[model samples]
Target: MKLSALLPFARLLCVTTLVAASAAQAQQVLNVYSARHYPSDEILYAGFTKKTGIQVQRVDSDDAGIVARLRAEGAASPADVILMVDAARLWRGESMGLFQPVKSAVLDAAIPATLRGAPDAQGASSWYGFSTRARVVVFDPAKVKREDVDTYEELGDPKNKGKLCLRSGSHPYNLSLFGAVLEHMGEAKTEAWLKGMVANLARDPKGGDTDQIRAVASGECAIAVTNSYYLARLMHSTKPEDLAVADRVQVVFPNQASWGTHVNIAGAAVAKHAPNRAGAIQFLEYLSSAEAQEVFSDANNEWPAAKGVKVNNSALQRMGGSNFKSETIPISAVGGNSLKVQQMLDRVGFK
Candidate 1:
C-alpha cells in the first residue's frame, strides 16, 4: 500500500450512515460552502455520493468571501454546511451567530471537548473543526543550521534577523498564530514578539506562504515560516512553480521541544436553521471518522482532529516525536482579538 493510500472511507467512521441513507432517499441535497480546495475532498464527495446517493453540492471559495456571501444571503442563505481553514474565521462565524448549535452523540463522542465547541455557552457549538494544520518555520538544511532554532519565539532573535522572511501579518494564518500567542504568552509577550519579528523581517511582508518559500529558495531569505503541507504539495506537484519552490526549501518543524507546534484547523458546522439537521449531523459525523481523517492527512498533509486518526507519516514523526500539543485556548480568543492583532501589527509597522 502506498503510504498515503492507507486511509479510505470504509475503515473510517461514517458517523450516521442510516441517517445519511434516509436523507439521500428523500431527494434532498447537502449544500456545502467550503474554503478547502484539496483534490482529495472530491474523492470524499464521490464516496459520499456512491454510498448514500446524496448529491453533495459544494461551492468552493475563499473562507472570508463565502462567509460574507452567506451573511449577505441572510434569510435566504441556502447553505446546509459551512467549511473553511483558519480557526479565527470559524470563531468569527460563531461570534456573528452565523452557524447554529448541533448535538450528536457521534460528533460529541468522536470530537474531543476542545475541538467541538466554542469557549463558552455564549458561543457553544457554533461549529466544529476537523482536519488540522500547523504554522511552523522551515529552512534549508544545507544553508542554515536547524539546531540553532526551536521555538517561534526564537525566529525574531537579532542574530538571525536578516535571514528570516514571512507572509503578511494580516493574513489569517498569522492572525491565528498571533491569537495562539496571545492565548499562551499573554498580550504583552505576544506584542513584543510581533514587534521584534516584524523588525527582523528580511523583506516587507507581502505574499503568500509560497512567496516566502520562493524568497528562501532564491537566497532572498534563509528562513520562512509556512504550513507543512506546502512542502508536500511542492514535492508532489508536476507544476514547475511548485518544483522550483521545493528545490529551495527544507521543512523544519518548529517549537519541537517547547510546545511541539502551534496548530489550527479546517472544519465544518451546520446552519442554525438547517431544514435537514439530521443530514447535516450525518455529514459532520463522517468528517470525524478515521477514514475521512486519514484521507485528509495522507492526501494533503493535514492533521486529523479525531483522536485515533493516523496522522504521522515518517517525515512528520522524524521532525518531532508526534507528541504535538495545541494551544489550550479556543480560536474564539483569536477571533475576538483579530482586530487587536491588526492594530498591534499596524503600530509595529508590519506593513
Candidate 2:
C-alpha cells in the first residue's frame, strides 16, 4: 500500500525540482547600471547575450545618479556591473567602495595598464577602461593657423584671447583635461594656466563639446576644446549640417610636441556586491575583447583601449595619425586630481 502511495509523491517532487532548476537557468541575468549614453551600446549587450545565452538588464543614468542609486541600494543592489564614462567618475565609484577588485587574465591582457585602475603588487584591477576619446583642440582653419595652435597651452596665450570657446568647467571632460595638466605642471602653474584660459574665453563656458564644435563652425569661436569623437560624430552624421560643421573645423592633437594629447575613458567595473559575479566578470572580459572593443568604440567614434587594437573609424584616424602619441601620465592620476582641477577652475572664474 505504501509503495503505490509514495511513488506519485516522489515523481511530483522530482518534476518540481527539475522545473525550478530550469527556471533558474533561464533567469541567468547580469544587471548593469551604466552612465554611458551611447545608443550603440545596445548592440554590444545584444552581442553578449547572443554569445553567452545570459540576459542583460540595464538602467541608464547620469554618473552622479548612478553613484547615488548604487549607494542607496548597497548590498541589495541589482547592479552586477557599473559602466561609466570618464576616469574620475570611475575612480569616484571605486573610492566610495562601490566596486570589487577583479582579476581576469583576459582583462589584464586586453586592456592597457595605463587605462585601468592602479594595480597593487598582485595586479588585480578595480576597474577597466575599454574605450577612449581624446580631448583635443578644434580650430577653424580659416580663422586660426595650425602653427599658432600647436599645443593646449597655446590656446591660453594672450594672442588667442577672445578667440577660444570651451565647455563648462564642471563637465568631467574638461576637468579630466585640466587634471592632467595639474599632474604635469604643478598646482601653481596649472592654476595660472587656468586663469589664462579663462581670460581667453571667446564666450563664457556654456555648452558641451558638440556645442563648442558647432560654435567653431559658425565662426562664433575660432578655437574650441572638445573630444575628438564629437568632431568625428559630426563628420559621420547623415545630416548635411553636421557634415558642414565637421568641414569647418580641423583637429589639432594638442601637446604633440611635448606631453602628447590628453585622453579620457569610458570604462566599467564590477559591483562590490554583485549577485552574479561570474557573469559580470565574463561581460567585463567580453568588453575588453578585440571584437567588442572595436564595436563599442567605433560606434561612438572612440578609440579602443586594448593594446594592439586600432581605431578603424576613418574620421578618427584622419584627425590623428596612426602614430599619434598619448600622454604617459596614468589616468588614475587624472582622476585623483579631478577635485583640485575643479577648485582651480572655480577660482579662475572658468564657467
Candidate 3:
C-alpha cells in the first residue's frame, strides 16, 4: 500500500475520534430549567455534580415563567430537568405534556405515592415531590386562643371576624391550600368558607407569608395563614426582628384533628424533550436521596418528601411539626382543584 493511500484513512480516524470526544463532553453536562430561586439551592446542584461528575447548567425563573419558557421552546428546548416549587404548576406542566413519565425504582421506593404525580399506565410518574411546606395558621396568642384558630375551618368563623390576614387567595400557595380545603369540604362549603374568610379579613389579602406573619406580630391582625417553612425561616433566623416575629406568634398545623394539615410540595421532573434523558433521570433520583432531602429541610426549612429521611433542622423541631399529621390527599387532586379555588376567591372578593 502507498503512504498517500494510508494518509486518507489516518484523517478519517482523527475526525471520528474528535466527534466521539465532543459527544462525551456533551454527556457530562445537564441543563436545568428551575423555578427554585433560593441561594441555598446552589449547594444542591453542586452536590449532584460532586457525586455524579455531571455539571449542572441552570436557568432560573419563577414557576410561571419557567412553564411559559418551556412552552415557547417546545421540542427544541435543551432542558434536561425541570424543578418547580408548586403542585399546581407541576400539574399544569404535566397536563401540557411538558414532563416525560419517569420510571425509577429508587424514586418509587423513596417517595410516598401521595407526594408524587399520579403514575401512568406503565407505573411511571410525571414528577416527584422532593420537599413539603405545610399551610399553617399563625396567630397572636394575646388576641386569639389556639383552639379558636386551630383548624382551617375556624379561620372563617364569625367569632374571628375582622382578625384574619392572608396573602392573595389566587397565589399558588393559597390555591393549593384552598384546593385541599375543597377536597375535604366540597364546592358549596368551600365557597362559603372563602366568603367567611373575606368577611373576616383584618385587611385586604396582601404580601407574602412572612409579611402576613409579621403583620400578626405587629398586631395588625390577630390571625394569619402562612406556610410552615416561612415560620421556620423566622424561627431559624439570627436577626432580632425575625426572632421577635417568631416569638410573637403561635403556629398551628391546621386540621390535625381531621384529615391533617394541608401540605404542598416543591417537585421536579424530566423535561419531555430532554436532550440528556439518562442524566435527567439521574438528577431526579439524586433529589430523592437522603442527603438532598436534608438540604431541603436544613437549608430551606422544607420537610423531606422521601420516606424515612430524618432532618436535623432545629427550626423544624422548634415549630413542633416533626410529628404532625399531614393530609394524605393526592397532590394531583390539589392541583386539579386550583382553577375552581381561584374562581371561588374571585366570587368572594378574597383579593
Candidate 4:
C-alpha cells in the first residue's frame, strides 16, 4: 500500500484504541447510594477502592430518603449499589423491586442465611446484611432488677408500669423489632403487647436510641429499648458523662433462654438498574470480608454479619454480647412484618 493509505489506517486504529481505553476507565467507577451517614463508613469505601482500583462515588442519605430517591429515579437512576441501615428499609427496597438479585459465592459463604434476602428461583439474593445490631433492653439497675427486664415480654408487664421509654414506634428500628416480635408472638398477642407497652410508657415516646439510654441514666425512665451500638458508643466513649450513662444502665440481650434477642442489620444491594453491576457486586463481597467486618465492629459498633469473623470492639465484649444468643429468624420475614406492626402500633397509640 502507499504511505498515504497506510497513514489513514494507522489513524483509525489509534482512535479506536483511545475510545476503548476511555470506556474501560468509565467501567472502573462505581456509584453508591448509601443510607449509612456515619463518617466511619468512609474507611469501608476507601478500602474497597484501594483493593480493586475501582473508584467509588457515593451519595449519602437516611434509609427512607435513599429508598425514596431510588424509587423516584427508577430505571434511569445512576445508582449502582444501595447501602441501607435497617432490615425493614432493605426489605422495602427489595419489595419495591429496587434491587436486582446477585449470585455471589463469597456473599453466600460469608453471611448467614438469615441475614440476607430470600433467594430467588435461580438462587440469587437481592440484598445482604453486612453488619448487625441487637435490639436490647437497657435499664437502671437500681430501679429495675436484671431479671425483671431480662426478656422482651417483661417490657410490657404491668409490674413495670410507668417505667418504660421508647422511641417512635414507626421508626425503622422499632418496626424491625416489633416485626420480629410479631413473628414470635403472633399478631393478636403482639398487638396486646404493644398496648401494654403504651400503658407502661414513662413518658410519651420521643427520642433516638441514645436519648432513650440517657433517659434511663437520668432517671427519666427506668427501662428503655435501644440498639446495641448506641449503648456501645456510650460504653466506649472517652467523655465522663457518656461513661457515666453507660455505667448507670444495665443491658440485657432479651430472650436468651428462648428464641433469642432480636437483631437488626445494615444491609446492601445492587441497584436494579445498576450501570456497573460487576463493580457493585464486588463491593458487596468486599463488605463481607474479615477486614471489612472488623472495621464495621470497631468503627460503627455493629456486630459482624459474616460468620466466623472476629471483632475486637471492647464495648461489645464489655456488654457481654460476644457470646449472646441472637434470634435466627430470617430478617426478610421480620422486615415483611413492618406494615402490620406499624398498624398495630397505631391502634395501640404507641406513638
All models, RMSD in angstroms: 11.4, 2.4, 1.3, 1.4
TM-score of model number 1: 0.85
The lDDT values for all models are 0.75, 0.88, 0.93, 0.93
Q: Write the per-residue lDDT of candidate 4 for residues 1-351, one digit (tens) a residue.
A: 899989988999999999999979877999999988888999999999999999999998887788788889989999999999888999989999999999999999999999999999998999999999999999998998999998899998999999999999999999999999999999998999999999999999997999999999999999999999999999888999999999998989999999999999999999999999999999999999998999999999999999998878999988885699999999999999999998898888888
lDDT of 2: 0.88
Sequence-dependent TM-score of model 4: 0.97
C-alpha lDDT of residue 166 in model 3: 93
**After superposition, candidate 2 runs with Cα above 4 Å error:** 1-27
Instruction: Arrange candidates by TM-score, descending.
Output: 3, 4, 2, 1
Candidate number that wins on TM-score, 1 or 3: 3
Candidate ordering by lDDT (highest first) = 4, 3, 2, 1
- Residue 122 CA error for candidate 3 (Å)? 0.1
* Tens-digit lDDT string for candidate 2 (220-277): 9999998888888888899999999988888888888899999899999999999888
Candidate 4 Cα deviation (angstroms), residue 79: 1.1
For model 1, the superposed segments whose C-alpha errors exceed 4 Å read 1-27, 119-124, 238-248, 312-325
The residue ranges of model 3 lying beyond 4 angstroms of the native Cα positions read 1-11
lDDT of candidate 3 over 1-351, digit per residue (tens): 999999999999999999999988989999999999898899999999999999999999988798888899999999999999889989999999999999999999999999889899999999999999989999999999999998999988999999999999999999999999999999999999999999999898888999999999999999999889999989888899999999999998888889999999999999999999999999999999998999999899999999999868998888884689989999999998989998888898888
Runs with alpha carbons beyond 4 Å of true place in candidate 4: 2-15
